[model samples]
Target: MAWGRIQTADGRTLSGMLTDTGLQPMTGFGSTTPAGPVEALDGATLLAPCQPGKFIGLWNNYHAAAEKNGLAIPAAPLWFLKPDTSVVGHGATVTLPPQAGRVIFEGELGVVIGTPCRNASLAEAEAAIFGYTCINDLTSLDILNADPAFAQWSRAKGFDGFGVIGPSIATGLDWRDLTIRTLVNGRERQSYPASDMIFSPAEIVQHLSQDMTLMPGDVIAVGTSLGVRPVKAGDVVAVEIDGIGSAEVTLA
Candidate 1:
């Protein structure tokens, strides 16, 4: 099943399940109770699938990319956080801040938490997972490397609209078989298999949970592979994961 949040034509926001016919309104996230009537997709605006309290992004989680860059695999997840304000839904416009010189798009898979977890075991973490979604972790590369003394991972990627995620969150997906593809202005820029990930989604959740409590609606971006490149104003960047669906953002 796929879950999503959307704005109806009447300007009402609803949480619902996405179906071929339309969105069937639900009482709440992960709830089986119906709230309102089914809404047609054509008349509704899709919002970010979930509002995450903590938005985490992993680094160098893919073996292929690690090998290509000659970086050793880490024993644990190397991560960063993106502010909630940086999040935007599918079809949203990402404005390039004046301070940003070169902005790049990273296509990644997002793991959404369903239940609160702290120091969870692997089995517990697996059970706590809600689903997966697509994410475009936009970065201001220029700002990232500006100061040699420190790598500003958070500041470099936490600009408004930089944490792009969701058309829907897909449950029961075989994430290992999924592939993440990125396109810039209709041309394919990245195509990588999730099998290349050095740390699987479940392992990431278990390990990270040991560090901090992961609440419901928290999201973890499973990092990107090679082929990430800069995008300019007017460019439309799309991140697609077969079962999870695609999220497109236009640069402004």
Candidate 2:
């Protein structure tokens, strides 16, 4: 099953269907059966799939990309956090805020938390998962790697619309065997298999739970591989993971 949050023509927001066919309202994101009203897709627009309390992301998780950047494979998973407001929905335009310089696009696999968990073991972590989705973790690289006095990831990556997720969340996709890709202007800039991940999704969750509580709706971006590239205004950025679907956004 797929889950999404959409906007209605009347400006009302609610969770619903997210497919090429269009939006369909349901009781909630956790609704099991798809027996809901066939509200006009135009009645609502898509919103970021979930309103997460914590948005955790990973770095150096992909082996190929780490090697390309002349970096060693991490001894352990490196994780970071982006502000909740960074999220935007599919088909939304990402405004390159004036303060940002040298913005880049990172296509990644996103894991959505289904239940609350803390200090979970690998076995327990496996049960905490809810689903998966696509992530376009747009970054302001200059600001991200700036001076030692001001190198704060929260400011560099927390800009509104900097984190783009959706089309929809796949509830039962096998994450270990997916192709993650990023395309800019019809050109394939990045492509790697999920097998390239240095750490498994369950490991990421288990590690994260040691330090923070994983709550329902919290997202863990599995990190990107070597295909990260710069983008400018008017360019279209797309991230697709086979079986999960694609998420496209325009730079504005």
Candidate 3:
């Protein structure tokens, strides 16, 4: 089943299970049964699939990107946090901040946690996963490397509306068979297979759980492959995963 949030015609925000024709309002978070009438998705506004408390994006997690960038493979995942305020759902218009130089879009697969866990084992981590979604981890490249002493990972990527995810959270998604793609203004810019990841989704969760408590809706972006370029003010950037869906944002 696919889950998503939306703003109804009445201006109320609700969570629901998404069907091809419409949305069935969920009983509550994580529930499978419907509690209200089916809603016509076209008349409602879609939101980020879930309200994530933390957004962690990985780096060097893809073998293809690692090799292309001439970076050595690391034993553990390298990640950075994007503030919750930066997150936006599909169809959002993202404003480019002043002095935010050369922003690029990263198309990735996102793992959404379903259960709270700390130091979870592989099996536990696998079980804790709720669903998967696509993520667009936009970064301000020039600002990231500008400082000599420290890398501005957060600032470079944590600008408002930079952490884009969701059209819906797809349950039972097979990472091995998935493909991620990014488009800028309707033209495909990046495309890669999910099979290229050095760390599987479950392994990433297990490792991350060892360091911090992961709660339901917390997102771990599995990282991106090559083919990233700067996005301009008028561009419409979109990240799409074969099994999940697209998270699109218009830059302004």
Candidate 4:
């Protein structure tokens, strides 16, 4: 099953499951809008699949990317946080903030936490996952790598619409065999199998939980590969994961 949040024609936002039939309202859903009846997929504007309480991101998680840069995999998952407000849906135009400077897209696979977990064991981590989704993880490269004192990755990554997540969460899929590909204006840039990850999702959760609490709806973006490139106004980026659907966005 796939799940998404959308704004209806009536100007209300809802969380629903996309069935073979249509969108069905989810109970007790908390989002930018109130719950409502089922609607056609064509009747609503799809938003990011998650309203993350905490958006955790990984660095050097992909073996290929790490090797390409001549960096070694750390002893554990290296993590950072992106604020929830940065999330934008697929197909939405990403406006470049003058202060942010030039931004680049880091297409990645996102893991959605299904249940609250603190210090979860490796064996239990899989059960805690809700599903997987696609994330662009746009970054302001200028501010990020330029700072001499600090990398400022957090600030460089949390600008509004800097985190692109969508079109829906893919549930019950075999992630290990999945392939992640990134395309810029229809030109393939990055392609890698999930097997190339230095750390698996379960291992990542187990490691992260040892230090912090992971709440339901929290997101973890498994790091992207080495083929990341800059995108400008009018450019379209598409991230395609084998089982999880593609997420596309346009830079404006």
Candidate 5:
């Protein structure tokens, strides 16, 4: 089943399951508590599948990108955090700040955590996943390298609307079986298989758990492969994963 959140006409947000017929309203996300009446899906505005407490992004996780850039395979995942404020829902418009300089769109798959996890085993990590979502890890390429003393990872990537996530969350997908494709201005820009990853989704979670506690609704972007490029005003960049659906953001 797929889960999503929609904005009501009254300016409130409602979480529910996306059914073929319509949306089956649920009392809360990731729970079997109860449900409300079914609503038509025709014109509802979609929000990011969940409000993530932590927006984590991985770097050099894919072997293809790593080999191309001559980066060494790391013993564990190399990651950075983007503040939750950077998140924008599917179809949202992102105003690229002037200070951002040149920004690039990184299409990647997303893993959404369902339960609290810390020091979890591989088996437990797999069980803790709620579902998957599409991600566009928009980054300020210039700012990232502008500083000589330190890499401004968070500052370069944490601007509002940089962390693009979700049209919906799809459950029961095998990460290895999925492929991520990116389109920029309606042209195919990236296509890669999840099987190219140096670390699998469960392993990513298991490793991260050993370092920090992961909370429900937290998102971990599995990282992008090749074809990451700069996007300017009026450009539409979309990241689509077969099971999870597309998350498109416009630069303005």
Candidate 6:
């Protein structure tokens, strides 16, 4: 089933299952209790599928991108955190910071946590996973490489509205067979297979869980592959996954 958060006309955000007919409100995320009547999709506004307490992003997780850039396969997942304020829902506008030069869009798969986990085994970590969603990990390239002394990874990617995710989180997906594609202003820029990942989702969760506890609604961006490029103002960026729906954000 596909899960999402929708904002009704009354300004209440509800967790629900996205159905062909509309949204069936749930008591909570992964909740068995039904909340209220179905809200038609057209009448409500979609929010980021989930509000992740921790927004973790991986780097150099794809074999193809590593090979192309002559980057060594990391012994572990190289990760960074984006502040919660960076998150924006699909159809939201991503305003570029005035001093932030040359921003780029990275399309990646997002792993949504369902249960709290710490030092979890692979099976436990897998079970803790709620579903997967599409993420556009927008980065300010100029700010990132501005000072070679220290890589400002978080600052570069943690700007307001930089973390764009959702249309919905899809459960029961065969992630291995999925592909991630990114488009800029209607033109394809990135296309890669999830099979190219150096560290699978389960491994990432299990390993990261050993270091920090992952709570429900935490998101782990599996990272991007080749063909990442810059985007300017007015460009509409879309991240599409085969099973998960597309998430689009317009640059302003």
The best-first sequence of candidates by lDDT reads 1, 6, 5, 3, 2, 4
Each prediction's number of clashing residue pairs: 0, 5, 0, 0, 0, 0
**Model 4 per-residue lDDT tens digits across residues 24-89:** 777743222435566777767888987999998898998888887999879999888999889899
| All candidates in order of TM-score, best leading | 6, 1, 5, 3, 4, 2
Candidate 5, number of clashes: 0
lDDT of 2 by residue, 88-203 (tens): 98889889998889999999999999889899999989888888999998889889888777766777888999999987888877887889899998799988888889999989
> Candidate 3's C-alpha lDDT?
0.90
Residue 185's lDDT in candidate 5: 86
**How displaced is residue 77 in candidate 1, in Å?**
0.1
Alpha-carbon lDDT of model 6 = 0.93
Model 4 residue 215 lDDT score: 86
lDDT of 2: 0.85
Query: What clash pairs does model 1 have?
Result: none
Candidate 1, superposed: residue stretches over 4 Å from native: none
Question: What would the per-residue lDDT of candidate 6 be over residues 1-252, giving only the tens digit for each residue?
Answer: 999988987888888898876888998887757898888887788999999999999999999999999999999999999999999999999899987899999999999999999999999999999999999999999999999999999999999999998989999997899999999989999999999999999999999999999998999999999999999999999999877889999999
Candidate 4 clashes between residue pairs 3 or more apart in a chain or in different chains: none
Q: Is candidate 4 or candidate 6 better by TM-score?
A: 6
Candidate 6 C-alpha error for residue 117, in Å? 0.9
Candidate 2 versus the native: TM-score?
0.93
Off by over 4 Å in 6: none
Residue-wise lDDT of candidate 3 within 27-142, one digit each (tens)?
A: 87678777889888878889998889989999999998899899999899998999999989999999999889799999999999989979999999999999899899999998
Q: Which stretches of candidate 4 lie over 4 Å from their true place?
A: 29-37
- Residue 237's C-alpha lDDT in candidate 2? 90
lDDT of 3 at 164: 92
Task: Please tell me which predicted candidate would have the highest lDDT against the true structure.
Answer: 1
What would you estimate as the lDDT of candidate 1?
Answer: 0.94
